[model samples]
Target: MARQTQALARICDVISRHAQEGRAPTALPRVRLERVSALTPPAGETLGPSVSLVVQGTVRTVLCEKTSYYGAGEFVVASVGLPVTCAVTGANKVQPYLAISISLQPAIVSEMLLAAPAPRQTTVSSVAQALATGIADPDLLDVVERLTRLLDRPADAAGLQPLYERELLWRLITGKHGQTVRQIGLPDSHLSQLSHAISWIRTHYDQPFSVEELAARASMSVTSFHRHFRAITQMTPLQYQKHLRLHEARTRLLAHADDVAGVGYAVGYGSPSQFSREYRRMFGAPPRNDAAHLRETSAT
Candidate 1:
């Protein structure tokens, strides 16, 4: 328990330093350490595939309709691209909220799984939602400590970072949520194939495509593709596309304050009224009003 506490403290120290400076203190790619504090609610943001650990205070993340809460000595894993809203639930000037995020590299995961023997499991599936779990084991905490320590020794990072990262992945793969990590790597697995199709849709969401074409890309029958896609992601392919479109439109509106019609067209919406209706349904406000409110909140 003492060792675990020390590990968490060390991680928090590094993240707090980075967050104050608004940039990482290390040269690592795709992984960032941060500490945050806020008195008001934050706008929903899209979190790509990543793992987050909280060293102090608490945070709540909502993915689609599912909500998860993590506190000190706990972690959350998001295995897919999903629209999520997250906020610091417990914070103040002194204690604040300390957290770190490491983006999951699918290729690294795939390589680790390939080099490892298959676990005794029936099948693999997409982990569409976020997962939160407590950290009870000391070994896992040690791996996290070593990873963070690399930031202090940039010279040793190239050789030792990969080794430590692999160990971290191994610990996660053998942990209670092992199946979720495994599903992301297995080729020809239903979840793996669907992830491919989903990735394509996300990248080309601006263009319209038919169900038949998407099914062909997944190499599954149209009926089979539709069923499996929804089963894995909790949303149909079309519904998933709608989520991506609306989320992207929201980003553009917030970033550039783009015109409603222009933002709608930019995200592949041909009808402005349809875009407004869908945006209202997803975000609880029309585009212009929502953007204005967001701007006001940010200013304060």
Candidate 2:
């Protein structure tokens, strides 16, 4: 326990020094450090295959109707890309929110699984959730600490980083959320199959698509596709697409606080009135009003 606490402290120190006001991509491979000094409003983001470990504060993430809160010494893993609303729930000037996120590559996971010994009977829950939270055990924290140390030694990073990453992946694969992490590397896993349709919707969010079309893309029957897609994302395909559109629209509106109708049409809403109504419903304000508020918030 002492060692784990020490490791976490070391990680917090490094992240505190390097993290920016928001997300900061680091020189280390696939690692991102985040720092937030104050509480933040919920924001939508599409989180890809990655594991994020909290080193200093707490975070709240909501996927559809499910809400998950994880604090320091805990980690969240997303086996597939998920559109989630996340906020920094615990932070202050004295104790800022800090976290490290590492992208998980399927190829490396597959290689490790193949080289690993034959499987033991699964211990995690049978029900699969694409996003999950787990307490970081001592082994996992140790591997993460070693990886973070690499940030200070760039010369050694290229040579030693892969080894550390492999070890980290191995630890996670055998940890409590192993079932969800393992699905990332399995081509035939339900998560993998769901990813195909998800990728399409994410890319062509502005385009109209039928359920049958998406089902075929995922290589599953329409009925099965609906079941699996909703199971992982906790939303129907239409709902996911709508969320993406609104999120994108919000971002665009924030960048340029003009063109409410144009932005609405650009994101695939056929009518300006419908767009305004839905935007108000989702964001609690009309498009123009929301955009202005967002811009004001950023300026301050």
Name model 2 segments beyond 4 Å from true: 117-127
RMSD of 2: 2.0
How would you encode candidate 1's per-residue C-alpha lDDT over 1-300 as one tens digit per residue? 898888888877766655662225347666676555654354466556667778788888765666777788888665666556666788777877877777777788888897776665543342433343556368887888788777778798888888887887888777777666666666766667777688898899888999999898888999989887776666777877887788788779987675999999999999999999998987788899888887886676
Against the true structure, candidate 2 has what lDDT? 0.87
Model 2: lDDT of residue 20: 88
Best by lDDT: 2
Predicted candidate 2 versus true structure: per-residue lDDT over 166-231, tens digit per residue: 998898877767777888898988788889999999999999999999999899999998988887
lDDT to native, each model: 0.74, 0.87
Question: What's the C-alpha lDDT at position 85 in model 2?
Answer: 76
